[model samples]
Target: MIALNSIVSTFNPDDQQKFITYLQSKNKRRDTKNIQLFKFLIKEELSSKDICKQLYNVVQCNAYHALRKRLFQSIIDFIANNNLEDENSIDMQIIKYILASRTFLLQKNYDVAYKILDKAEKLADENSLFPILNEIYHTKIQYAPYYPKIELKDLINKQQENQKKHQLEDQLNIVYAKLTSLLNAISYKGEIIDFESELQIILNAHNIELQDSLSFKSLYQILAIANISALITTKYYQIENFVLKSYSILKQKKETEKQLFYQIQIVYLIANTLFRNKRFEKSLNYIQEMQELMLLKKGIYLKDFILKKTLLEALNLNYNNQQQKAIDLIEIAISNKHRDIEALLDLHLSLLMFYFQKEDFTVAKSVLSKFYHTDQWYIEKAGIDWVIKKNVAEILLYIEIREEDLLYSRLKSFRRRYKKYLTEIKQTRIFTFLNFAEQYYKNPEGFSTDITRNKIENAFTWTTVHKEDIFVMSSYAWLKSKIDKSKLYSTTLELIKKA
Candidate 1:
């Protein structure tokens, strides 16, 4: 095990000085070797060998190990003696009391144990720590024989109630965890085939009901599950209704920091639903609403929330033919160092699409270089389905730069590698493109034909035909631009206007 002081030192630098001071004051040793050792562990980047030579002046391995164990115990004692009093610390405070009761009861201190247990019971009840409440009830029952004043009837009834509540809480947590796992799985694939039967099985097994007694945590899980279901089946309107109902539940209660965050999250969900449904204007309204809510709160995680909103806004702008504005927003979003690799990948891909559509081949090439540079390793790390979009982006780039040789090579390689992942309809589009590209590049005289025009029109329709496959970039517009011999932005603008 690591020395507790060493683990604590790795925390935020802002807390390091105060923690060090606490350790120094609690050292309580005349030799001061323990204090020196604690200071050495915290500040200096010294190895065990360095410590043996510099601090202890000993080469024996056992000496360093013994010193580390002692330091660990000292830090544990200091942590046990010190307590922080605050709202955030209330749970720990209750836990501390319960632990104290357990220790006192083990030593046969009945009166003291009962006093501590009573205090712990009140704290746990007030905080709705049902699990801890169950523990307290168990401790109460175990000590009931020693306390003559203990009412067996009342204690048993309360214990039964707490146990029931604890069971319900556990069930809800299990369902929530399962829903979260489901979300993660669907995020990569972007679809789940015929989940109706499976959904019924899960629902029946969990006995899930989102009603008045449901806690905010459980309600959030329900909303998440609903969102995932909608995304998998492309049922955006259903999710919108579910979110509205859940938002009503939230508004009926007192506002808190947690509620505020969830409120923003709900609005984001609504915005995304509208965006996916191609109601860009309405989506922008909700995006603005989310921004307004974000302005009222301050937190560390809020940046990620803001970035999400920005990305959605950029998507809205891009699809609405406002490429420059979308590009600007995407640049701003990617400027931040995001911890979410998927979000970063989305931003990079969006930027590539915008620059490519803008016909700024120079900037597009730069973005493509960065995409190619990181995407290979990043996709593996992030576990997202980026290959389809990545290959599509490469084809678009090669087509633009008139790199017929590279385009043919990449097309052949992509077909061989990712054939299984592509749907039949998607594979048909790829084959059509490859055949057209081969003719267009190898024989310029045969580039434009009645057959080519028909293929381009069909490809354009397939964008909506396979809209459910969001992982596919639907490269129909680029093909259309090539067929019509028009600017890519012009074609996109016309299409947006027609929509």
Candidate 2:
């Protein structure tokens, strides 16, 4: 029994001679029966198919390569004789296991593959001969994927069924398409049809129940849906709710490769939503959480997440009254040049606002000069033109206030450029107020007419939708204070409370 166990244990034929010598010296394999058993064991390990034909040539009862080959063929024939289904047959299962395990190996998913192979070995033992079973088991121990305990067949089947029933892929495509259409509509650059019906379709596909027993794929789908919903509604509350729910589910699940992907997505969504809602401090917390998670999974590709986290950190610091630190971080991000252009542009815009608030024209001019030098400056032609006109006008107007030499000619030129882009600007209250503010500053005496006041009030109503930005609220309050001090004071207080 010990010899038999040793024979089964030799995984490679290179070690067969050592075992054969040990067995022969023990005098247990001098006879034909014992010699044949040894040969069979060697053949099973080597997977040789011509060993039996050469058995007659060997006089001594020792390890023979020919006998080893013959025994290997016999095992193969046995497996062939037994009908195994293509999908569920033990042979097919083993093949699929091998393929899947190889894929996981490439992905560095060793634990998952090892778990899978372990289960496969148990299943194989119930249906295969000892020689074949031993070979399969030893093969698994040698080469396994990460997380082998996760049975691929079961996971694939479950995910496939869920995907079909939920139409998750279809729903995601629809949502992406709807968002594209909505953005096009806002820009008047594409289809003008309403996307409400399509939005409904996407919302209907969200299965909150799946969150209770969330798989990695399900978590991914949920995150995608939540992000799309947030974009559609422009509401951070919905995003917060879904992200928190997804985070809870990920916490419950094992940290598999798929789960890691979901984790990254969830953290990104949370951070972005918090930033959009102007919950800067809360956003920073989520960014820190994401950074920790990424550190734990050291080799993961997280360039996008890192950039976004950096942006959030800078924005949060600025909001919390740490302007210098915020500016420093923004400069770091810019110097790295590793972030997306859009994010960089946003950072610069925020920095511009900060400088404007501080009345630091020298630094603001330097920052704006660098910004206009970039390729993105040309890309944001409309916004850049508006900012130049607006800022230049304010600077010239300030100089006039200080009783400096008034550059009326330059002011007129700036006003002309501002008016040139006025019609192209979106009808949002913020832009309208910006336009009115420019005009009011240009000629305060004539611009305080009732008609102008009514238009500013209407713009104020629209601006309230984005109450998260204190600058916008303060501007609105200033306009209202001009009309009615008591109403402006109360409204300003209310906005502060909401902030």
Highest-TM-score candidate: 1
Displacement of residue 162 (Cα, Å) in model 1 is: 9.7
In candidate 1, which residue ranges exceed 4 Å CA deviation?
A: 1-172, 179-197, 209-213, 233-238, 258-264, 288-298, 303-307, 320-322, 336-338, 372-376, 424-453, 456-474, 493-499
Q: How much is 203 displaced in model 2, in angstroms?
A: 5.7
TM-score, model 2 to reference: 0.52
Residues 1-499 of candidate 1 have per-residue lDDT tens digits of 5754446443344334555676678667766566566667666577667776776687656766777787777666554554343223666777889899889988888889989989989877755567888888888888888788788778899999988766766776787677666655544543443454566667779776654334445556667667767755665655665677676776666544434566677778878877766678989998998888876633323555766888899989887767789999989778855556677777887788788888898888888777655434644554434556667777768877898798888888877765654452134556566566656666655655678787666654343432333222335556556667778777765665444
Q: Among these predicted structures, which one has the highest lDDT?
A: 1
